[model samples]
Target: MALQLIALSPIVLISSYLPFASPSNFSYPAIFNFGDSNSDTGGLVAGIAFPLGPPNGQTFFLKPSGRFCDGRLTIDFLMDVTGMPFLNPYLDSVGAPNFQTGCNFATGGSTILPAKANSTSPFSFGIQVAQFIQFKTRVHEILAQDKKIQQFLPFEEYFGQGLYMFDIGQNDLDLAFYSKSDDQVLALIPTILAEFEIGMKELYYQGARNFWIHNTGPLGCLPRIIATFGMDQSKLDEIGCVSSHNNAAKLFNSQLHARCVSFQGQFPGANLTYVDIFSIKSNLISNYSQLGFKQSLAACCGYSGLPLNFDNRINCGETKNLNGSFVTAEACNNTAEYVNWDGNHNTEAANLYVSSQILTGKYSESPLLGDSHLLAISEI
Candidate 1:
């Protein structure tokens, strides 16, 4: 009956999907989310939640999850692991009772800066951050109305009792390169990082401390990107990895890691740690089985034929028995065998595995953190 359960019931009912969520491991009081679709939870699809995605999440939702994948996303797994309630999108009607365990200020395609023109797009990273600031402001203003900040003793320190997760920046690359030049994009990375710093400081200034920063995933491997532009899987770098897009992704990861490390150093009392999702994603691609994933590169549902493109691509959920309008290209009997659920995102099963790795040692294919790793808080 709680909101998190209400949100998760459909996801678990259909597939008995194991999200790998560790609700028992939450070390922080609140969980703040910001990012694109990967960690969106429910920002991008709020407007079009009915039409475009029903076909996408048909298996579970009996409708659309509005998520880019076939099942629960990485954030769902994180909340489950931490023992926190499912995080509601901050912008939801606020009709859902008790909407404050943590709010997702993340819109699907929104950016970091306060740009007026991007509202039409998915919640931009900048836009999402701004929304959080607004939410916090609203909370404070209302508290003032009731004289609660001073009168309410226990709730006084609510701001400091939270954790934040930000996984963004890939969309900037997509939008910039599509419209601007590569050089222009490269130049903007510094500016992007700077804005990111501002957002971090904004959260810190407001009392947020526990933070998990995720790096961008490989852009080159996505089906939508690769369909038109092909990459030769043969070339290997010093690490014996492929060339082209994923290579660029590798480069981005390096820079992202360095930037986060610098941030951790700059922010005082902020327990910020880099998630290295880039590295984890890369490894999933390199060896699917190594990560308990089946297929890393290809989409499980879509046109698996000689002709490949966006129009030809399709997601899992709907059964298109229509004559020629629908054609199944490639599909694994069990999605658990594949990493990618759609063209660009991972399947629910895939997300579970990744979330396990992120939680340190609660669950994972490999050990990445120490047993001494403690939750930032003791109370759920």
Candidate 2:
């Protein structure tokens, strides 16, 4: 059976148990995000050899911002809702003028675990945390040299009050699945969570108090997964997703949720909220019609004529076929009607929906962002 089902009722039901945190007067001065392609703004494009071009960011930016999707990612929308400027990638050639606001340390193919033996890049979560540490030191140095910028150099004020968002672990799980048995993959969960715990503790030591942690989504439902692993009807669940893979994702989320609960108990005065992206993605699939999504199991952009309209060899923007023929990948006229943007990511519209759900604070473990004690700090 798939891992225990998450509450999929209306938003009201899911949020009924959450303690009310009023949003009447709340604001976040900065947001520091860490993750992989799911939340990468431009780090991957700037640092890696990944191919990200047109048609990827056509829906919103009208040009590529190095995000894997056509428009804004969930992190981008979160910033918009919080009134923060879109985060600049830490690796961007043109450095952001203001580190006071925050910077993104996420790279596209980043994993929580160190890069595998065969992996091409070594930008793991550990490295991102190291970068954050370097950034903190740089801020202190600048503050010491110039009194004019000292206001922005308040490490405790900014780091303690800022919101830290994490959207990693998907790539780690994906690698595990392809290389190890189901039981082996399950065994890796504890190690992954340990890395997360260590990372969080380091941040806490550095004055980061508030955190928004997103669990992995339904991996089996991705277009690429459906094409690769859902070929057999018996293996596919009622939702046209591979049951085994989805079950694995559920297991990971379950363990992660429990860890978050433990973290709350272990760390005094820390606000670590777990975001249930698994349930949100599942709900979207189960309620696609109500959500105005016409295609829930296929990609909005990919090579045409392939199973589930996804071709592993081609990306979203490539217009030439593998045989050197001129053939463009099919893209939906209205991306808003599709849940997936490419084979592995969500469309801008779907991201908008997901971000709205997260903002509702119902999906979080404690007081929603609006009611978060971190936001209560009047300094911002």
lDDT of 2 by residue, 241-329 (tens): 98878988998899988888778788858887788899888888888777767788889898765347898777787876577778777
- Every model's Cα RMSD, please? 6.8, 6.3
What local lDDT score does residue 276 receive in model 1, on the 0 to 100 scale? 67
Off by over 4 Å in 1: 1-25, 47-51, 58-62, 94-97, 113-122, 143-156, 180-184, 231-242, 290-292, 306-333, 361-380
Q: Residues 101-211, candidate 1: write the lDDT tens digits.
A: 677776666555444464445456666776777877877777767753433221435568777878887776656656665566666666777778888887787778777
TM for every model, in the order presented, reads 0.76, 0.87
Error of 1 at 174 (Å): 2.5
Worst window of 10 by summed lDDT in candidate 1: 363-372
Where is model 2 more than 4 Å wrong at Cα? 1-25, 95-97, 148-156, 367-380
